[model samples]
Target: MTAYVGKRLAQAVLVLWAAYTLSFVLLSALPGDSVHNRIANPEAQISPEEAKVMLAYYGLDRPLAEQYLHALGGVFRGEFGYSLSSGDSVGHLITSALPSTLQLTGLGLVFGVLFAGVVAVLINYGRWRWLRSLVTAVPSLFASVPTFVVGIVALQYLSFRLRLIPSVDDGTVRALIAPAATLGLVVAAPLAQVLATSMRATRRQPFVHVLQAKGAGEGYIFRQDVLRNSSLPVLTLLGLAVGELIAGSVVTESVYARAGIGQLTVSAVNTQDLPVVQGVVLLSTAAYVVVNLVVDLVYPLVDPRILVEGRSRRSARWRTDGQAVESAADLPAGSARRLPAEVAMP
Candidate 1:
């Protein structure tokens, strides 16, 4: 288990490094420097020489390799540099915006899991076959709809027409409803689909039949066996859904006018603020890696078979080594084990 965790951590670091390098390269390739972007205002007119000086001041005139090394070092020290557009510390900007994004992610994940769980239960455990089929199909339909479209529809209907919630920028819990639901519905679709399929397969397994033969009730068997077995896949999907949540947040926050890392990212891109953009990308990559690492660590807890599988592999290796040793011992002291005669060394 320790070795597995160490391996995963190493892989996570490599992934983060790759993401950072790619983001830096792409941002550097973008036309116009921060100075050019800032000097675009006619009232704040600046000459080409002045722009050159500004670039040099910001160390943008350095070689690409030097700049990359400096940026990487800054990241390790939690120094994200200054935002070219706002003149704010990139680290400060990210920290300020991170809480909102975290809240949105948490709410969306909770809502999605609850929605998927309810739908899966109705589809698998309910009596009406037609209704169950309809419930099963809903997730696919929801999955097809883009999160932005959902956010727009929710704003139009739930907030404006129905008056069920406040406007998107109202800065209240009620304002979170539309955007959270938009993201939740998008993520819930795939989760529910996977879970429903897993549940159906679990129900058909021989153990379920054995439970039935033992006179166990349907509810008992479902609660004790089916749900537990089906949960491993669901847990995996939940980890993967973090990416979806992050992607969806960019659109959802834009539509809802929320202050978050998503909004920060968009603004940084529009202004070509390389440092802030790189910071956001790095932060997102870290979040993804950390979430997946947690999922890997928790996997053995969910299914002991994972640990057992590792043990089985080790046991097999040990058995092979023992057999080789015994064969060596059985051979005469001065003789070597026979090798295939196909092409023995000349």
Candidate 2:
């Protein structure tokens, strides 16, 4: 366990570093940098001496190698440099804007999980064939609808037509609902799709038939056996969805006129604020890495069998006579464990 955790942490660090380095290189390769763009602006009307000093201050006068090293060092020191347009510390701007984004992300993730769980359960277990078919199609429809479109419709109807909740310039929780729901729906679509598929496959396992013959109701069987067994794939999909969630938050924030990392990202890109842009990139990368790291750690808890993959055959043996092994209690009772558990007893 210690080795696994340490390995995941190391990989996370490597990913973060790679993301930062790539972003810096790409931003540097842009036609003109923030410093030149700012100094060249006719409105600034700066003299040659001031321009020279500005270049020096931003380290544009230094070699690319030196600049990269300096920026990398500053990152190590917890300094994200400065925003070219506002001349404010990039770290400070990110710190200030982080709260709103965090609030939205957290709310979005919670709503997403709830919505996805309901949809997945309904998809696999609905009594009526028509209802099951309809529920199955819902994920596809959700996948087709973009976050911006959802946000627009919600904003117009909820805020303008109905006036049910404040959408603009309202700092309260009421204002958060529209955008967070938009992001949540986006997050829920893929999750529901993956979870439903997993559940469907898991339903075909032989143990489910035995449970049915034993008079286990559908709901009881699903809750007691299928849900837990199938959730490993859902956990994996959830980790991958972090990227989609963040991306959707950007558009959602824009449509709802919410202040957050998304808005900050739009402004930075429009003005070519390289430092702020890089900071956002790094922040998003860190979020993705951290979520996946947590997912990796959770694998063992979900199914200890996960820890068995990609290593030498374990130093363990399965019980020939099953007396309710906690993990495989639902699999079979009074059955000898075969090499792959595929043996059929006559």
Off by over 4 Å in 1: 39-43, 47-49, 318-346
- Lowest-sum lDDT 10-residue window in model 1: 316-325
Give TM per candidate: 0.89, 0.89
Taking the tens digit of each residue's C-alpha lDDT, what string does model 2 give over 1-346?
8888999999999999999999999989998867797678899898899999988888889998898899999999999898888889999999999999999988999889888999998988888999998998888888899888888899889999999878684789999987887899987988898889999999999999999999999889988989999899888888988898888878988888889999999999988889999999999999999999999999998888666653323432344554433334444667765433332222
Across 48-127, the per-residue lDDT of candidate 1 in tens digits comes to: 78878878767788999999998889888888888887778999999999988888888999999999999999999889
lDDT of each: 0.85, 0.86
lDDT of 1: 0.85
Clashes of 1: 0
Off by over 4 Å in 2: 314-346
Count of steric clashes across candidates, in order = 0, 0
TM-score of structure candidate 2: 0.89
